[model samples]
Target chain A: MTYTAWILLTASLVGLSCGIIGVFLILRRMAMMADAISHTVLLGIVTAYLITRELSGVHMLVGAIIAGLLTAVLVQWFHSRGVQQDASIGVVFTTLFAIGVILIATQVGNVHLDVQHALMGEITFLPWNTIHLPVIGDIPKATLMLIVVFLVVLAFIIAFYKEWKITTFDAGLAASLGIPVVLMHYVFMTLVSITTVASFDAVGAIMVVAMLITPAAAAYLWTDRLSVMLVLSGAFGVISAIGGYYLAVWIDTSISGSMAFSTGILFLVSFIFSPNHGLMSRVVKPYTTTE
Target chain B: MSVLAVRDLSASYHKNKVLYDVDFEINQGSLTGIVGPNGAGKSTLLKVMLDLHPKLSGSVVFFGKNLSQTKTRIGYVPQRGSVDWDFPTNALDVVLMGLYGKIGWFKWPSKKDKALAMASLEKMGMADYANRQISQLSGGQQQRVFLARALVQDADLYFMDEPLVGVDAATESAIMETLKQLKENGKTVMVVHHDLLTVEEYFDHVMLLNKTIVKHGRTDETFTKENVQATYGGALRWMKEA
Candidate 1:
């Protein structure tokens, strides 16, 4: 595979995994929480590095999961205690992310970790980082991780389709019918955390939020069926991946940053041109163009 | 024998007490209406019994078993406003959620499940709108679809929270009709109702509540004006005028 092919595949997988799980985040109205979780996981990564003295995928993921869940629990606790929702999210993420920054500045002495890498991922290095496997030979580590993460995401959706849907749509009904609403909530959050860490290297921290929320939000405008919406979310993410890659190369810009920009652009286009719920429909609704 | 029983049920949110020592029993086939003013724990009672909220102290038994044990025998119709209408599912699909328990975990709904859901929608006069997205339905139509979903549960007992708050008269009559049919078929149904004027007319058994049960029994005897005033107290001038 050429250098461009590997980078595009990795970027596409990052977009696919984040975009698919992200439909739930958008539907559950937890998009803001997704952003918070993405940022706060940096704290988990830094703390794990401090303890382990080396950054490994498995260890970093475990740390990210623990930190992500902690942030979720803390945000929920504060909101339940009569604190406003946005305020709780803001306080928890900012405090935890600040701690992560402090740890990185103090402890990560001469280490390769830096805020710039975490924020705007250097995707040019993606092709060079290869892992040799038994049958597939040498594959980029990001590609391998993302492929596994994407499959798990697909399995989760396939296996728990009804449970996740009913819970997101109506919690009381889900609980009454013997579904463990709280447990299901945490389970889906764990999936999001996994997707976040898997996609983090390709999209970085800030852009990961864009990958998770933007494509799904854009797809949400086009379809009234969740199954179709899921497919569209992944497709749009791939489109952004493909489009942003060319844009980045053409302009000599950051690939992840360009991809995030593409997602925003797609969202804007969807917001205006969506057949059913778009601004065009709103304006032309009274005219009722019967075609 | 009573189909449902509650004893010493209390639930609190933070430092505030929502329900305290609320106890009640409903006989089999009783169409009991759980009524109270705002914040009287009407919804909280159902939520606690269903384990949606953490209970401070309570005992809820359905058919001589705990909630998890009798879950298949239980169904719930949450408030129409409880769910987002723009949930990207058709009316039939929403109704299909009713049978999620029976379909078992990790298994897709078969043709039989879809037929059951369609049948349930037909009962609510919603068969024609089955394929339509839920967001396109009218307020009353949406309530009817919700009732259809609960019907698909086919449970021995059902609990509903404020199913008639903003629905039109047609939906009100449709829901009341279904509730009556459920009772006639020997199913115990409990509704969290808000309208005080329709208590006696709509329910055979009534539980007038204000953080606790002011009265619980046959509506003719328990739903008297005095009991209602005592339950609502001066907090409701609307009831006084009525």
Candidate 2:
């Protein structure tokens, strides 16, 4: 029931969710798109607050999902038009984010969300906001959201393992097989959006991208199968989340940054040590006599 | 019966016309070679026939129904390089994709589906490479894997885009055998082929195309020098060995 314990619980759950969705982002080669989606959610948050003049968590989640879907659609449109896909994504999302920044600067006179808060999140301060559940007693609302999202993503992947795997591997092939490739793609981007927005309140904008990409990229080094990638990415995310929490506690700085740092370090380690794709592993392969 | 039909099919990319008023029909239990020179819209025609291109204007009918309605009755093997060969998936996993339409969403491949995929791999001489990552495959192995994927569809019609490109002679022979088998089983096999030399040997019917169909008939008739000249803009004469 300590604040520190609450922080660790929240970080671990959110990290788990990020890792789960990160697998698809990595598969789709949309790491930068995921980064763009995280930023655009800030705009959505600002726009929603301006319209409703309220700060409810659910409202922010809804707004963020809409903005996230829009960003994905824009990326697809540009890519299909024969434009350079990544640069178009960068241009579209950053423009929306700049608008959000200006809105927050000029319009929000009293809200606690400033540029600094959006960049470096406050996990230590998250424990005090109580959402009391009748069965579970008092828990941080962000922790509860993270748990729900993680379970939903886990169930979705488990249920649609064949469809997701096929689409990730070859979208045209999946479409030819009548698997509704476009619809599945939109559904995935929606989940990524939800994860990014949810993490916005916990890990902030920049660090959420780190969690979304790093764990999955690290898992990429380890496996060539969707099932294995999903499991390994989730594990990597959870470890980084816990490790980052402690590192932040020791360093006396931001918890989200520490989580991102830990994820980056894990990615580097996997890049070197992964059996099939790792640099050091390949270099050491000729000398090893096991084969 | 003609299992597939296309009428007045015109397609363009960014306002540049690729396929123009092209019409074709594919009967069941036949192998049709669609041959054309470079930039002759061979791939574009196949894509339009499969209803994959939205900019295409045409009617693609299968079994007397619209293309969308006949989706489950058709299998497609795109170009071997159309996707990232380095994608993190194995050969068996790729083959299993053909069963997705029949199995529907959120459903696992049944035991029968796995059996079918394995059988298809074995048919293509790729059963031993079932667990190997697709990128680890040679060009011929990659083509055979694609053929296996199509075979697992168990559909009435098959469309393969340059299935023999970059493949070794042995792989080419394997693919020809598989296509011949599909034809014998009463499936229509339409291949977007580039090489003219194999047209006489591999296909029973031929369509010589250069932005349009200049000739389509039995292979021996349609593979004549004049039709080949028209399809290749007189370039075929030089490429041919006397």
Candidate 1, which CAPRI tier? high
Q: At residue B204, what lDDT does model 2 achieve?
A: 99
Compared with the true structure, the alpha-carbon lDDT of candidate 2 equals 0.85
lDDT tens digits, residue span A1-96, model 1: 999999989899988888899999999999999989998888988898999987767777888888899999999999999999999999999999
Structure candidate 2, residue pairs in collision? none
Report how far residue A265 has shifted in candidate 2, in Å.
Answer: 0.9
Residue range B58-118, candidate 1, lDDT tens digits: 7999889988889999998888888899999999999999998889898989999999999
In model 1, the runs with Cα more than 4 Å from the true position are: A283-291, B235-242
TM-scores, all candidates, are 0.97, 0.96
The complex in candidate 2 yields a DockQ of 0.67
